[model samples]
Target: MARLIDLSIDSDQVIQHLKHEVKLKTVYQSILCKQIIEKASQERGITVEPEEVQAEADQFRYDHKLESASQTLEWLEDNLLTPDDWEAGIYDQLLKKKLADSLFGKQIEAYFAQSKVQYEQAVLYRILVPYSALAQEIFYQVEEEEISFFEAAHLYNIDEYRRLACGFEGKVSRWQLKPDVAAYVFGAHPREVIGPIQSGHDFELLMVEEFIPAELTNDVRQQISSQLFDEWLESELNHLVYSQ
Candidate 1:
């Protein structure tokens, strides 16, 4: 049997490589997942049509704004991929998505409805500072109407865009936030100023400008379905047993 890599290096070097090379684990996981996907796809008689693969490849070009064939070819060269290689990769991805949909698409709506709260979005303003006292001062000023949150954010926020936009983090779901931050922000009423909360090296002042409760829009349903399918695939992969 062929091993995955050269074993000619010193034992200490091998040990150090194994310890420090994080991407090696990810590569191994990808290989294992592909094997599983291939087997499952075959058993289910799932196949990718050439037209579908070509359409996907065309869409990929369109998405990247590759207007000309030469541009597409140049992009392929830059990415170290040939046209056939790119098409094959797209085919594999499409096959996996189809298989996942076949297995789990029917469950998406119920899952989205059940887990809706996690998907609720908030339009937020924030001021992040290194010191708690400064964060508190800014929060009080915003709260008292002495300074708008945007003004405070523009003046004091450490984040680049927050400094420019007055701390607008845009619309974000709970899962996109740190656990403690999500807990505080999601529970807050719209337009309420809340914070001086610690996050990493910074204390943050948060204001919820608007709260958007979760609704099972077509897009949300699709997202929930894909998320559930991914979870199922992960669980299946974890529980796979091998025989010696």
Candidate 2:
């Protein structure tokens, strides 16, 4: 390893950067994931085809708007990656995807069927206030028809974007929210006002404007497949008992 960077960078700064990079949680996970994917690929006889690699490279070039081979080379230089490293990285990614699909593809439909409620989305309006008393007051006002949820949110909610949007949170699935918040929101009837529920440091009043039941669209199925694959990876990683 002939010092990845030149002498222009201070020795102490380079040491510090290396130390920080190695210690990052994402870096650790990426290394573990690579190890797991390689093992799985071997066991399952999964492979990266030349056509697949070329297709991925083409898509990458299109995404980065690299109009020519020179531009692609410039990008590799800027990223400190050689052509071999770039192609190997692409192969590793494709291998992982192939391995996951091969291992978990058949389980997706069953998993989706069992956990479909987690994917159901709710269109919501919320009024969040710092104090429990304020949240309760807003809830009462809305309940009594003295004020609408949107009006109260505009007047008192601390989040500026939500206030401007009249407290609309667009649509969110149960898995997208904190456990406590999701429990209340998903269980409540549509158009029913609910909550003075504690959320972190703030208290919130939420109303479910509408609920969108989960459907097994192609996109959703793919998402579910990825989720299952990730969960399997985590469990596999956890059970590896290493000894020096």
Candidate 3:
């Protein structure tokens, strides 16, 4: 024979709140995503300072017009989250970003060092002649070197931007050009005609008018560093997320 046990009754309001149901699997996954973030954050020696959290929370509240953090928590809970979950998400994001910075920060400096000449500012004159009978005629004139690139551009180019600057497209980076274009622009002796180059549906002629090498400008290094960090973060995050 077994003995029966009785449980105490709670107030109706308490019972109603307690009855709020959430999916077991969702709760479990939320816990897992939370743990991953915490572990990653700890590995990086990052602390989500109170002021920072508060600032984020304050902004969240202001954006959503929520009364307080507590309300925010309740809303999150209703959407299947806890405060821990939110904090973990934030921690993971910040820590991942920081780790990326630490990892890729040096590479950016190296990149800037090696590619400084490639980022040199230049004034270019270009003529875009459609693939037609006129193309060979224009190409011949430019190739003969009898007429200057500027003269050819003024005579035959139809692109309005070229017309305005007397065919000058100022301050371009070699990396910004297509592989073929970069080769031509950087490989040529300065002031030489570079192309009857195929570009999309047209043929182009280009000449480098002037070039200014990239100086060690303020914040340029930082900008490159930040970009590198972002790239690293994306790669790392992709690995992490896909690994599981």
Candidate 4:
């Protein structure tokens, strides 16, 4: 029997597949977001120059280790994208970035200043267990130097994968913690042990290592930009839906 070669799928087939997989809503939202960016950027005269798109594409290719044109083409083939499709994607991303900066760049510093306290970070080691009695036992053991926080977490934490991490939740911000837990952890001094407190189903014992004062670092700037852009996008999307 002869073999069938390289079957092709059309846009309608792709849409049908998305619907079948119950992913049409997610794909639809993404398409709407792209349309929003294109329209809004054009209105604001936020054009993404060819040079900018080329630079972005080069950076992307470098990031993905696609060093040569052949390697890039192979990658595009693997990802089911043609050169034009990939270039258009890079252009779309650059346009969105320019639009986001134009709309929210001036407001980031003010927003960061307002939310500075929420960005304060803490380094803590934790031991969490199912019961309070065991937690109290571990607390005393740790307090008296009979056992270390790391050792207790290694031995007793029920979540095996998290046992490693519970021993070191590196640089968690105030926003990341529950309000009650944040209050205790932030108030405690360095090297202080606090908790065996009720955390939903588990009792958690935390040992604070250090506190990091919030600063407007580059990472935080990028975070704020993304955050503000997402908020704007969601609001625009909601308005569009409601008006329709």
lDDT of 2: 0.85
lDDT of 3 by residue, 99-190 (tens): 54655656766788877866666667788878756666776776787776777777777887786565777767775787778888877777
- Candidate 3, residue 140: lDDT: 73
Candidate 2 wrong stretches, greater than 4 Å: 1-26, 60-84, 241-244
Clashing pairs in 4: none
Cα lDDT tens digits, model 2, 12-131, are 676677677775556566788789889989988888888999999999999999989999998998777888899999999899788878988898889889999888989989877899
Q: Which ten-residue region of model 1 has the weakest summed lDDT?
A: 1-10
User: Candidate 3, which ten residues in sequence have the lowest lDDT sum?
Assistant: 1-10
Q: By TM-score, who's the top model here?
A: 1
Global CA lDDT computed for model 1: 0.83
Report the candidate with higher TM-score, 3 versus 4.
4
TM-score of each: 0.87, 0.79, 0.52, 0.86
Q: Write the per-residue lDDT of candidate 1 for residues 1-244, one digit (tens) a residue.
A: 2123453456566556766976566656677788888888899999999999989988988999999999999888767678898998998899988888888778877777677788889998888899999998887887789998888889998999889988898988887898888999988988788888988888998989998988778777667767876787777778773431
Query: What tens-digit string does per-residue lDDT give for candidate 4 at 1-244?
Result: 1112467777788888899999999988989999999999989988988899899899988898999999999888778788899989989988888999999999999999999998899987887799999999999998999988888889899877768665776788888899988999999999888988988898989988999999999888888899999999999988887899
Q: Which candidate's lDDT is highest?
A: 4
Better of 1 and 3 by lDDT: 1
- Alpha carbon lDDT at 107, candidate 4: 96
| Model 3, residue 172: C-alpha shift (Å) | 1.9
RMSD of 4: 3.5
